[model samples]
Target: MTDGEPIPEERGAPHRGAVWGAAAWSAGVLVLLVALPWAARHRLPDPLATHWGGHDPDGSMSPTGAALFPAGTWLVLVLATAALHRFGRRAATGRARGATGAALAAGGVLLTGAQASIVHANLDHARWQDADPVGTAVAAVVAASALAGLLTWLAARPRGATPAGPRPTPGAPVMAVPPGEQVVWLSRVVNPWLQLTAAVLGVCAMGGLLAPASGLIALNWSLVVPFASTSVIVLACSSVRARVTARGLHLGFGPFGWPARRWSPADLESARAEQRGPAQAGGWGYRINGLGTTVMLRRGTCLVVRNRRGAEFAVSLDDAERGAALLNSLIARSDRTAVTHGDDHR
Candidate 1:
């Protein structure tokens, strides 16, 4: 590397390999899962279905298995594929490798669980359920445990070093900055857990409505409202702007949605980033409380500021410590400028 010479970007082949490998593995797993019940149905006598108390007296697979298994398997496989893409972007390190492996394993287990849930929920409906029920159940448990173990192993591996210094320590107070400098920051709304939960719930609700026993026409409406509302909220937070100027602070999110909130700079006092646990922080989203208002998801850093009225305004940002530092500098400068002008007037 020489001064003025552009450094060559590292190729992404290995990461790509990992991603593709994970995808292939997940696909194979899904295929095996689907094939198992079919094979068992053929091998065992139909009397086993009756013995197992399946809802289907004729030893036929339940509709639930057909629907949920494929859906869940596909969802997990997609997530694993995405994770592999992310993993490939980072330079390979022990930690990165571990994380990648763990993510893949978790994806597999979750995929399996999706299949198992489908089977378990409709066990009563399965005909010719197979003679060795205990053995089959044990195998499923062992497979689940193996998947979990792999994920744990990967998660526990050390992370690769970055050219950048260690990520800002979580919960550290942001350093202050001087006023009059324009600062920009980016935030993303990527909450897998929330999205997954909502999706599963929505799917279940839809399935219930379509089932023969369904009497609650209104149940589907209940499902649609929350599903739609969450989708809107998530979409809105995908991209947002928080600008601090002499006039005031402007906060806007989503491409076309309305701005969530805004406040005058005069009303803004000190700003700091705080690390809050999920339990304390209310699980993600724009949250307000006596201490102040905060926007966060899971466990990450957030920028919190005090208004002139002593109320706090907090926003979740990637690289939150840096954002908080920038905000602090701006507020300190403003305070000093105000004091200097007051002294001169006196």
Candidate 2:
């Protein structure tokens, strides 16, 4: 087993232990959101204050509505994430799982905190409008939600993510560049599964962005902004283009290729073609597991590179052999040039 490879336990989707843990955690969160408000029903006003405008209450819902609203939203969120875990291209990956867990954790906290605040404010009030200002409580709730999300993300990160990988392969394929010849290799890969996921998120974001006009839900910029931003990011990462030239490897991302990464030949320790899969690379898209950073679109042949620090970076693509060969050749050429310069100076 190489240093960066996934162990037997890390290869598959939806581990049994993880499933049960998530279910239990979800149940706990649901209970907190529902039970707290219901338990305090006797003290709260018949119609509880829900939406606050500035310092005063501006919107209200029945005691039953108040209890069920946040809980219902939480339930929907849980179900959506559950579907994603079961069906998403790389949802089972450590990074994906951690992201899902973190979102749920933060959402659970926000829902439960809001419910608790509402119940507390409405206590001993004759009317929903008379409820005390909950600005401080709202701030506290947001802080707690953020903290919980961060903690969950940190806890779920893959353990022992050391920057170690397979040793440099001397037998790896290489291409020879003629003395004055210009060689450039271009390769691109697109993940339809990721594109589909991004499209779905984009549709949802569009709906959320327009929901305010519909007057169906109390949808606001706070919810729409993050959702839309996420959609854009996912769409941007759905496709990747790799270009190898005398300058080194240039990776362009998305259709427009706005965000890209470049690595000079001198910066790479070694380049090789390695057979890998989502199971081995810890799921799809961009990932960093024990295997280091992998821009894994689909699994199979990957152009893997190790920097001087022994840190590995990989990208799954077709004709990876040619790409790796060209990269390795460039590195070799750069090394020869450096050695020649050194000898001249001496």
Candidate 3:
């Protein structure tokens, strides 16, 4: 098989154990979500307080509705993840399972927490309107959900996930490597406008929050929080670094590079450089369009790679031509090494 051809077993099919574990976790969480509130039906109001507006309850539902709503929502999320693992390219690549696990974990925790809070708030209350405030509970649950998601994403990452494919088409650019010499290409790109925008939004969000707390001015937390979130999201995609080496392509996002992507030589089908614009990529920041996922920051020339699944990832950077050429060369070199090793074993 050529390098670009995926192994028979790795053809976008999820591991059975992973599927079972995710299913089990989802079922257990769903049961707990429905059971906890039902178990305390006698203690809770006839129509439990389910939604809060600021410091007071503004929405309520029948005991059964309260118990089933969140459970049903959780069920839908579980099914979505199951479908991803069952039918998408993520099954074999295991690339998105971390995110899927994170969503599942976070959703389960959030829904369970919400249900628990509702039950606790409505306990011993004759009417749903008389239920206690759940503002603090909501805040705590959100924090817990975020923490759980992060932990799950980290834990669910596929281990020892080697690339599975034979070499792709031979037309990809090639760079001859000298014997006993190592070749590496590194490039970094940043959009100052995006960075400045993120900084401005972050500062505004902080000021808005602090002003209200300091008695300087009144600001809605909802607005400030969204601003802060937007700032963070924008900052994360404002800059990117790319490196091509023997290990293949390494891409780092944001300044600290906390979130990164890597592809080994054997995992790639092809690499090339092409001119791309934000319009083509559907605006700035990280974009997923018909052209595939593009990290478009003031796009001009982009280094694009097609992986074994035929998925393309493109990043705007300077000197992209050389980077693409180097990656293709590395892939070719890896293919040659594999052939040599096979002959030796024979």
Clashes of each: 14, 0, 8
**Worst lDDT window (10 residues) for model 3?**
160-169
* Deviation (Å) of 322 in candidate 1: 2.3
Q: Of models 1 and 2, which has the larger lDDT?
A: 2
Could you report the Cα RMSD, in angstroms, for every candidate shown?
A: 13.4, 14.1, 16.7
| Least accurate 10 contiguous residues by lDDT in model 1 | 209-218
| lDDT per residue as tens, model 1, 188-217 | 333444434433443343234332211112
Ranking by TM-score: 2, 3, 1
Candidate 2, pairs of clashing residues: none
Cα shift from native, residue 287, model 1 (Å): 3.2
Report lDDT (CA) for all predictions.
0.48, 0.73, 0.73
TM-score of 2: 0.50
The global Cα lDDT (0 to 1) of model 2 is: 0.73
Which tens-of-lDDT digit does each residue in 1-346 have in candidate 3?
Answer: 2234432322322244345445655766776677767667777778878888888889989989987888889888988877776788434354487798789878977877777677778877899999999888789889988997997676555432223323333444766667556756667676767766665675466445433432223579888989889978876777776767678898878655648999999999888989999899999988999999999987698989999899999998776777777788777787888899999999
Which runs of model 3 end up more than 4 angstroms from their true locations? 1-172, 217-220
Task: Report the C-alpha displacement of residue 56, candidate 1, in angstroms.
Answer: 37
